[model samples]
Target: MSESALQSVIHTGDGRTLTRSEFLSLINTYNWFLKDQAQLHLTYSQQDRDGEVTVEGFLNISWGVTMPIRLQIQDDKQTPPSPLITPEISIPVSPLESKRGMTRWGEYSDLHQIDENAETPDIIISNVPPAPIPYETTTLRPMRHKNTEQEAESNLVRCQSDASLVKMRRKAKTAAQREEERQHRFSINGHFYNYKTSIFTPTHGASTKVRITSRMSTHQVIEQLLHKFKIENDPEEFALYCVHQSGEKRKLCNRDQPLWERILQGPSEDIMKVFLMDREEEEVSNDVAQYLNLELPILEQVLLKLREEESKEIQRVISKYHHQHRLLSNVLNCKVSPHIETSV
Candidate 1:
């Protein structure tokens, strides 16, 4: 074995470099000493951080029992396009045999054997039958016993019964406790759905109206809004609608006229504008007014109030995303802008 260095030519792209055939020759020389016929698998990993490259070795799987093996190569000098070099190999041995075969270099002892004629150990047998003893007999002592020096003690029937009842109650309570903690993933229309909190800045003609769903803290709502804005460029289509306190009809409209115009220039926006504009034009202005309140302050007030209930809702939704879906939590963490594709 070579001394562990901050680097080896294998990673540093230095030292006596071997061609693919020469490197395999070195591996073959060392591998010839291996006595076991097990089909050993090897894994290799290489990393380059802060300048130098590092190579790591680990067990891929047991010999003979095959598995999908993975390898990572990091050196620019040795990879294809350049003359490829075979990597150096080191055989591993168990700690127990390491000392015996110790050499100035290192030890490579025969550990696991895959002999075809290896004898199997015989199984041991026992004659005893298992017994199920009562809880009182095994754990609790009887109050009375048939002994010469003592008369039979009074019955502990009540005490034993009370203990049994207590145990039963505890068991029942524990079961109920688990049931209480069991989380029910909320669902609607027979499908599991997460609570999506969004801020809508709708545009009605020249007016901009803001509406928020899922009242949460202002910071949390703004953060979520920022995230939405990054992913959804056209905020107007999300539609700001007013559901009046008096149970009036809901009205929806764009809140950012300039943004709405930009959106309408796009093909999808043209379709939406053509459809929704004609539809809204046919309705009475008051009917539109009742549902789509273009009042700016009211919309702003609604956004301001959203945070009052938003903290709990964000917590609930984020927890679900963390434990259930594992979607937004990472995005939330690192404060990764939503526009970045994490997988890429």
Candidate 2:
């Protein structure tokens, strides 16, 4: 922690302060390493989470918002196994530590019961270097070990790396890759009528949308919906029933298109529903209630999303055509330039 960082900052009620980046660096190193050591998460106020990252992947600080940094230990290595931390907290294994090597002090070390040849990674907290003391005291100060020196170097390397946006090695996107990304990530105006024979929740509400792609088959859509609802039931046991506005119901096969293109060609008012009925059931019961009022609000939102999707698609097409035209003009210019040179 640099004291210079405290010049423009607010403090908690108990009078503690550290930058967001500094706090993350401290906890994610040594005894509190979530990814490499303890395998835990760092969460903050209102159930917001931090450190959802991999060893190679990057995580950055939220400079706009900061949270308090008082460490709280919920579990500890104990005999009886209570929820609180024991009086003596066990030192977590550091990544740089080795199982080999011996202590410089040898027999005089407090841990004389153990073999003197083996090295211990932990250090006495009291032996930490003094901060501008008037003079040295009798209390022995620990000198830098090989492991400690290596740890400092490793930290220096990590600190040199960018702690804001992540940088990655990637190639240029192909047309197919761009299309796939747009399908999966970009939200659009889409409506699915779900006729349900079984209730998912007691409070009746319209969860009007599911994440889907145009190329997804009926089976994939069913699997996605089941996973979204946290249903453990096998996907094979269920089937989708497509109900036409004219009340014509048809069960779609596994390989069939989940969103039937033909059905989508119908007028806006001629809305159809896809029922997630059990395969064992003969047919959907007429009593499965329909609440058009609740659905109308959702349908309106879908229309708005659809307009945004169309606008985006139009822009993409226009850009693609412009790029093609530029290429074609370049080719023509190259051919014409050679012909003029021959004539000259």
Most accurate candidate by TM-score: 2
lDDT of 2 by residue, 29-112 (tens): 522433453323333322125322211111110111011111111122222322343435335555665565432433322222
Q: What tens digits encode model 1's per-residue C-alpha lDDT throughout 1-344?
A: 33434223432121223233443343444234332532321112334554322222111110110121111221222322322333344446545443344222122121111232333333345897878963446356655445653332343333243334444455334333354334222211122222232222223322211223211222332233324223233223232222223323232332222221211122122122211121122223444444354578886776677786798799988887678555556557658665655673
Separate clash counts for every candidate: 16, 2
Which ten-residue region of model 1 has the weakest summed lDDT? Answer: 57-66
Candidate 1 residues lying further than 4 Å off, grouped into runs, are: 1-123, 127-186, 193-236, 243-284, 287-344
Model 2 spans with C-alpha error above 4 angstroms: 1-207, 266-270, 283-344
Q: lDDT score, residue 41, model 2?
A: 35
